[model samples]
Target: MQSQSVPRRWLSLLAVPLFLAACGTPESPPPEDAVVRVVTPYTVRSLDPIKQGLWSPEWGYGELLMRATDDGRVEPWLLESLEPESPTSWQLRLRPNIRFANGNPLTAAGLAAVVDRHLAENARVGESLPGADVQVLDDRTLRLTTARPVANLPHLLADEQGISVFDAAATEPSGDIYTGPFRVRSLSAEELVLERNPNYWGGEVRLDEARIRFVPDPQARVLAVRSGEADIALYPPTEALAQFTNGSGPSVAVAAQPLQHLRAIPNLRKAPMNDLAARQAFALGVDYRQLAEDVLGVPYRAPDGLFPDVVDYALPTQRTDAAEAARVLDAAGWAPGPDGIRQRDGVRLAVTVLTYGSQPDTRTVAVAIQSQLRPLGMEVTIASVDDNYAAMRDPAGWDVGLSFDGTLGYTYDPIGPLRSFLTSGAQRNFGGVADPELDTLVAEMEATPDEAARRPLLERAQQIIAANRYVVIVAQRSSPAIVAETFAGYLPSSVLHHISAQT
Candidate 1:
């Protein structure tokens, strides 16, 4: 199941924007001093950094103590320095005179409060830093201690979706306060308007205003950029990317690596998937190479392992064999029926795939998998839902789920994805896979800080996942954003928090 090249029809879809550009009159561009509008599929559900996770910092409303670069380096952002005092304790020093957008000074006490709030409110953060204690030594310095040794403490703080520094004085969730380059002017469900923070500790802010519009539809987001209504569009349809590359429309800004990947998690608690042979058959049936090369086109790579090549501990590519998949099913007592669908006893070899429209690629890949698995006598039914995460919670409803997994992108470490998705009782382990060996390996990786020493542990963890087929990785894709020709300094990042617009 490999494609030599993308199909002719996909290449034909590139003509859509060209046709629109020739016939329809483009809208007038905004004034030079007007707000720079950005259209995206994501919506801000809450103003609170604790509730919104990395979105607040990504939107320029807040800042973190440390930041991870595009090339896997963790450096001080809001902090002056971070040094480990002992295996279980570390000291943090914040830069002088950093203040929130609302003029409140950011202090060690405020950071401690933010940590406390995150530990209490955000389960993900609490899980990463369990029994963590933060003590303010002074206005600018603090000590963080954990019950167990956390070698990757800096990595945890640098996590895009991890702890964010906010104004502790403000008791309520308001967008007005945060130590960032921009302050919230107005916020609504549809859009968020931000103004330059004149008192920002970091150098002068460039953009006067930035407006982020939450447009759920991918085509609508593309239209917003095509019509000159928006200066930037995030996560547009991949087929329409050719229109931007010719310099007639928006320029395509791609991340260094394809950190985000499409993964299918099989429900381990449900029928068919609970059987290891069935899970292996499901993994073997899908044509991942064809999906990446033909359907997704350029910038998308075939499924390799849980993490991409950029990650040092990533595993080698896994091959798929439809014949082997059929043999595995036959050995498992699943026989092909009159309709060509496999069955064991009275139950048919059927699975309902769960996906969401927010990420159009999920639905596209799901449909492609449905067609590919038909030859293996596996019945794959795709169910497009409004909420992908909520829908996947019920293991009884869906046997397989298709969604974009960015765990490594958010944390910049293999431990992040392994611990969050593959480990036993992980926060995002919707598949209900409880492997004790994997759990122990992830714990060892967490405790071992040295990247060189953690290699073997990481390798074994990936092997367990591949052998068990706990999650079927589909494809890895670059984070693409369409930027207007007028804008000059918008850098696309694997971690969304690193993205910023400069005039």
Candidate 2:
């Protein structure tokens, strides 16, 4: 499904959460037939998909459609098939013999109700395309009509957003609601325990019970993998690489996906970016190779353009020219001043860039960026806001910030992110870039059924966004998830952090 536009105000809501340190990381998959241990960096706060971002693991629980990797196809779980009856409308055929974990029969009307409920909840939270973009047709077969034609409907449907269809009554007076592969048995500040859905429609779930033991530190995560204390985990840093040992003690598996858009967030309302030349200077000054190699590590490769893996249009380009940056700075009327920093009309070319230090690497990369910009006589102050990544959408956040985003779908889908920028309330627009040409192309791409016609528009959008340096395309990262041996069935689909299973 296309991304629901996030309001600018929503940007303020994205920030590093204060880590609720679990007493200590728990041991790996329990000996019991059904128990599994999964490790992760951040703790999930909400079971509601609309309140949190759609693809979050909290949304990817006991249910949701898993994407097939071979050709990047969509397969079903709760659904049997979702065939389109019309360009604007489609019929979702639900598997007839299915039941919720609570033994409620899975019905189409119940699914429709969940959709409406999620829309209402998100709309209240300032989402622009909430209920405004969806319509449910009937009880057995819910018909959906979009504001525009979307080729990525299955991708949208496969998301964890409203995928979990709960029985209508369970959703009515609930403190908690669930309909995935696992049912939440209990949860607390320290742990979240889940039991396999006995009535799961997808046959037998691989394991019986799964518990997510929160480990806030990357080093601790690595230790768990080696000690066989955890089955799967995210946020393994370079320091923890030794533990992998080429799939050592507890063998490891890794997965990586590069995002289509990276945030080169310059406050359009602020100076510098407001001065087009200043924005260009910052864009050209960045060195992509160093950041990718030093910060991202050996397995990582820099992106060529905006989208990675896909040829023509990628982010980490084969270019890193300091001369180009200097030329742009000079063209913008920036001359060397007493401080050796560029000054145009008595304004020093210095600004603070905001990013969270949770992962730790972003800050190191930011330092490299600082040294590169310093020679160009620009002063950069990089601050760790922890939860501050979302603040860029707010004009008051910072002069600039780092933005990296990607969606797991058939291919690099630019329509959603592009539309996010054009739509009035989109939370993704930190740089505040708006172009009629881009808007037109994005609209056409969304409505058109032809891939041949759409490719050029997507290409053009990436080119211009990169050319304008809206968000400096630092690197389209190849996603890397270092996992433990005891863990298997980690498909990177099914699960947002990592599709996992107990070996």
**Candidate number with greatest lDDT:** 1
TM-score: model 1 vs. ground truth: 0.83
Task: Candidate 1: list runs displaced more than 4 Å.
Answer: 1-35, 45-47, 102-104, 121-123, 170-176, 188-190, 239-246, 326-339, 342-348, 407-409, 498-503
Please give the distance, in angstroms, between residue 22's alpha carbon in candidate 2 and its true position after superposition: 18
lDDT per residue for candidate 1 within 316-360, as digits (tens), equals 746789999999999999999999999998999999999897777
Best by TM-score: 1
In candidate 1, where is summed lDDT lowest over 10 consecutive residues? Answer: 1-10
lDDT of 2: 0.58
TM-score of model number 2: 0.78
- Worst 10-residue lDDT window, candidate 2: 4-13
